[model samples]
Target chain A: MRTVTRLYLSNDTSARAAGAGVLADAWSEHPEVQLIRISSRGAFYLEPMVERDSPAGRVAWFNVTAQDLPLILSGTDGTPVRSIPFLAQQTRVTFANFGETEPLALDEYQARGGLSGLETALRIGPDAIIEELQVSQLRGRGGAAFPVWNKWKVAQQARADQKYVVANADEGDAGTYCDRMILEGDPFRLLEGMLICARAIGAGRGYVYCRQEYPGAAKTLRAAIQKADEAELLELDGEPFPIEVVEGAGSYVCGEETALLESLEGKRGVVRARPPYPAQSGLYGSPTIVSNVLTFATIPNILSRGGAWHAALGTERSRGTMALQLGGRVKHPGLVEVPFGLSLHQILEQFGGGMAPGSRFKAVQVGGPLGSLFPASQMDIPVCYDVFAKAGAVLGHGGIVVYDHETDMVDLARHFMAFTADESCGKCTPCRIGSVRGREILERIQAGSGTIEDLALLHDLGDTMKVASLCALGGRAPYPVLTAIEHFPAEFRAKLRT
Target chain B: MREQVKSVLARVRSKPPNILKALLALQERLGHVPTEAVSEIASALGVTTAQVAGVLSYYPDVRLTAPGRHLIRVCMGESCYANGCGRLLRELQDRLRVDVGETAAGGKFTLDTMSCAGNCAVSPTVMIDRDLYGRLLPSQLDTLLERYK
Candidate 1:
C-alpha cells in the first residue's frame, strides 16, 4: 500500500477566508497528499491549522499560510500541535476530535469513537440514557444553565404521536463561535449527538436550526448530513431517523427555544409563551426537545465516557468542560475548553495570554452581548453559572469578549441596547418598547444632553424590563446597560459632562 | 417574475407551516420576493398574502426589493465593534457613498450590518456576498472592493 499522509484543512470562518489561500496553493502542487478538510481545533489562534498524520502520530501546524506550502511538501517534520500545553493540558471530551479528523468522513469518525455514544444509547435504552445525563450533571450550554436530563425526561415521558428534536444552532451571541465551529468542523458530532437525543426520545425527525448568518456552518452541516445519510448512520432503532437543517432568517430572538420552534415551523420568528414547555408540547404540537448545538455536541461524550466521569470534571452543580471563546482585545483569541472552576484571570491572563501588547485590559463581556460586563477588579471570579449569577453576571455561552481601556462603556452599553432594539421580535411591550427607551436614554447621556435623574430612570426601566419581558432577549437587554452603569459608573458619569 | 415564483412554489410542499421556507426559496431564486408572488405563495401555502407578507417582513434578510450587484455585510457584534467595525463602517460609507441598510445609486452594492457573524476570533469581520473577510482594515477596502466589481 502506498503511504498517504493526511493533512487536515479547517473549515472555520477565520480559516475559510485565510486558510483557503494556502489550500489552493497546496492542492495545485501536491496531488498525492490526502488533503482532508476538518473542523476547527477550538483554538482559533492556530487556525488555518494543518494536521499531518504520520506513522509516529499527528504533527500539526498553526496559523499556516501559502508560504508554508514548500516546507510542508518537503516532508520535513511539522509542529506537533497536541504537545502544545494549551491543547495538551485541557480536558477535551466534547472537542476531542476537533480539527483532527475529516468532518464527515464516516469511517474516520467511527475509528475515533464518533457514534459510540449512539450505539451505547441503543444498547442501554432511553431510561438509562436519561439517567446517564442526569448523573453526569450536564447543564444546558445555551445561556440558561438548565439541567439537560430534565428536558430529555419530559420529552421521553410526553405521550405524543410524533416527537421532534432540534439542535439550536442560532448562535447570535456576538462573541461566541464554538457552536459554529461544531456545526462546521465536527458537524457529525452534533449530528451524532442529535441522533443520541432522537434515540432517547424516540423522535421521528430532527432539525438543526442554524442562523442565516452562518452560511458556512449551514453548508458544512448540510454536507455532513448528506454524508451521514449515505453512510446509513441516520438509522436509529431500525427505523429511519431523518434530520433536516433549517436556516433562521436573521432573527436574534429566535435563539430562544419557542421562537426557534416557531421559526422551524415556518412562521415569523416570535416568542411563544411557556409552561407547555417545548418537551411538553412543541414543534407541530408534538413533544420536542430543543437543545443548543453545544448541548447536543456534549451528548456523545457523556454516553461514551460514563456519566460519573463527566460529572467529576467541573465544580459542584456545573459539570463537564465548557468551550470558552476568547475574543476582542485578547492576545491569543481562540476556543479553550476547560473544567468549569477556572477564574477569569486564569482564562484571560494564563490561557488567553492577556490583552494585546501595550493595550491595557479594561473589562470582559462574558456570555454574549446580553452578558454582564465585568471590570478588572473581578478577575479572580471563577467563570461558573452560580458564581457569575451571584456577581449579577451570566456565564451565557461562556464567551469572553475583552475590551481595552480606550473603549467607551457608555457607548458600548448604548450599542448593546441598540442591538436589542434592532433585533427585538416586537412580541411584547416591555422588550419592544423598553429596549428602544433604554437606548434613547443611553444615547441622551452619550450626546451629553441627559439629566442626573436619567440614571435612576434607566435603573427603574431596567428593573421593569427584567421583570416583565417575555423571554431572555427582552429580559436580558438591560444586563449590559445596568452592569455598565454599575461597574463603570465613572464612564456613564463622564458621558453626562459636556 | 410570476412564472419564476410559480416554479419555486411548485417544488415547495404548499403546506400551511411551510410559508417561511417557500418565501426563502422564492427569495433565493429571485433576488427578492416580488409582491405579485405573495398572493400565489399565500394560495399555495393555504395562507393569506397578508400572512405571507407578515412573516416575510419579520426577517431582516428577506427583502421586498432586489439586492445590488454585490452585498456587503459588516459585522457589528461585540468583538467586531470592539475591534473597529465603527471606523470600518464609516470608511465603507464614505468610499461606497451608501449608508448601512441602503444601496448605492449605481446598483453595485448594498450595505448592511449583522449582530454578529460568529467569526469573532478574527474580529472586525465583513462579508461581501458569499465570501467572509476577517480582521479587515480601512486601507484594505480599495483592493477588496475591486474584486467584487
Candidate 2:
C-alpha cells in the first residue's frame, strides 16, 4: 500500500476567515496527501494552523500560509498539538472532540466516546436522568443560567401530544462563537445531547434555530443530522426523532426563548410575554424545552460522566466548565473552557495571553453585547454566576471582549445603543423607542453637544427599559450602556460641549 | 418575476407551510423577495399577505429589493467595532460611492452591515457574498474590492 500522509486543517468560520481555505486549496494540489478538515481547536491566533500526522503524533504549525506549504509538506518544522499551551491549558468538556475528528464523520465521532450519553440515558429512565441533571446542578449555558433539569422536568411532565427540543444556535452575541464552534465542530455531540433531552422530555422532534450569519455552521449541523439519521442514532421507540435546522432571519431578539419559539413557528421574530413559558407552552402551543447550543452541547457529558461528577467541578451555584470566548484586544483570542470561578484577570493573562502589543487594556465586556463593561480595576471578580450577578454584570454567553485605550467609551455606548435600537424586535415599546432615544443622546454626547441633563435622562431611560422591557433583549440592553456610563464617566464627560 | 416567485414557493411549500423557510428559499433563488412574492407566498401557505410581508420585513437578511451582483457585509460586532470597522465602512462607502444599505452605481456591489457573524476572534471582518475575510483594514479595501468586481 502506498503511504498517504494525513493533513489536518480547520474548517471553522474564524479559521477559514483567517485563510485556512487558501492553505487547504494549496495542499490539495498534491494527490498523495489526504486532507482532513477538522473543527478549530479555538486557538484562533494560530489559524490558519495546520497539523500533519507524523510518525509520533499530530504536529501543528501555527499561522501556516501557502508560502510555508513546502516546509509543512516536507514535515520539517512543527510542534506537537498537545504541547501547545493554548490547547493544553484548559478543561474541554463540550468541545472535547474539537480538532480531533471530522465534523460529519459518524465513525470518527463514535470512536471518540460519542453517543455514550445517550447510552447512559437509555439505561437510566427519564426521572433518573432528571435526577442526574439536578444532582449535577447544571445550569443553562445560554446566559440566563436557569437550571437545566427544571426545564427538562417541566417538558417531561407537561401533557402535550407534540413537544419540541430547540437548540438556540442563534448565537447573535458579538465576540461570541462558542455555540458556532460546537455546532460546526462537534455537531454529533449536540445531536447526542438533543437525543438525551428527547429521551428525558419525550420530545418527538427537535429544531436547531441557527443564525443566518453562520451559514457554515448550519450546513455542518444539517450534514451531521443526516449522518445520524442514516446510522439510526436519531430513532426513539422505533420512530426517528426528527431533528431540523431552522435558520434565523438576522433577528437577535429571537435568541430569547419565547421569540425563538415564535420564529421557529414561521412567524415574525417577536417577544412573547412569559406567564406560560416555553417549557409550558411553546412551538405552536406545545411544551418545548428551549436551550442554547452550549447548554444542549453540555448534556451528553453530564449524562456520560454522572451528574455528581460534574457537580464536583465548579463553584456552589455554577457547576462544570464554562466555555469562555476571549476576543478583541487580547493577544491570543480564542475559546477557553474551564470550571467556574476563575478571575477575569487570570483568564485574560493566562488563556488570553494578556493584551495585544501596543495596546493597554481599558475595559473588558463579559458576555455578549448586552453584557456590562468591567474596568481593569474590577478584573479580580471571579467568573461565576452569583458574583457577576452581585456586581450587576452578567456572565452572558461567556464572551469576553477587551477594549484598549484607543476605544472611546462614549462611542462604544452609542454603538451598543444603536445595536439595540437596530435589533429591537419592535414588539416592546421601551426597547424599541428607548433604544433609539438612548442612541440619540449618546450621539449628542459624542458630538460635544450634550449636557448633564442628558446623562440623567440616559439613566432614567435605562432604568425604565430594565424594569418594563418584555424580555432580556430590552432588559439587558441597558446593562452595557449603564455600565459604560458608570465605569467610564470621565469619557462621557469629556464629550460634553464647552 | 411572479412565475419565478411561484416556482420558488412551490418547491419549498409543505403541508404545514414554513413561511420563513419558503421566503428564505425564495430569497436564495431570486436574490431578493419581490413585493409580488408576498401575496403568492401567503396564498400558497394559507397565510395573509400582511403576515408574509411582516416576516419579510422583520429579517435584515430577507430583502425587499434586488441587490447588486455581489453583496458586501461588514461586521459591526463589538469586536470588529473595537478594531476600527467604522473606518473600514467609511472607506468602503467612499470607494464604492454607495452608503451602507445601498448598491453601487453600476450594481457591482451592495453594502450592508451585520450585527455579528461570530468571527470576532479575528476582528474587522468583512463578508463579500459567502466568503468572509478577517483582520481587515481600511487600506486593504481597494485590493479586497478588486477581487469581487
| Highest lDDT scorer | 2
Which residue ranges in model 2 land beyond 4 Å of their true spot? A1-3
Query: Judged by TM-score, which candidate is best?
Result: 2
Score candidate 2 by TM-score against the native. Answer: 0.98
Task: Write down the DockQ of candidate 1.
Answer: 0.81
lDDT of 2 at A41: 93
TM-score of each: 0.96, 0.98
Query: Over the stretch B11-128, how does candidate 2's per-residue lDDT look in tens digits?
Result: 8878667788988898888888888667778998998998888888888888989999999999999889888898989998898888899999999999999999899998889998
Candidate 2 residue-wise lDDT, A294-344, digit = tens:
998898888988999999998998899999998889999999999999999
Superposition error at B77 for model 2 (Å) = 0.3
Q: Report how far off residue A192 is in candidate 2 (Å).
A: 0.6
Candidate 1: chain B TM-score equals: 0.95
Check candidate 1 and list the clashing pairs: A39-A185
Task: Residues B76-149, candidate 1: write the lDDT tens digits.
Answer: 99998779899999999999898888998999999988888988998789998878888788999898999887
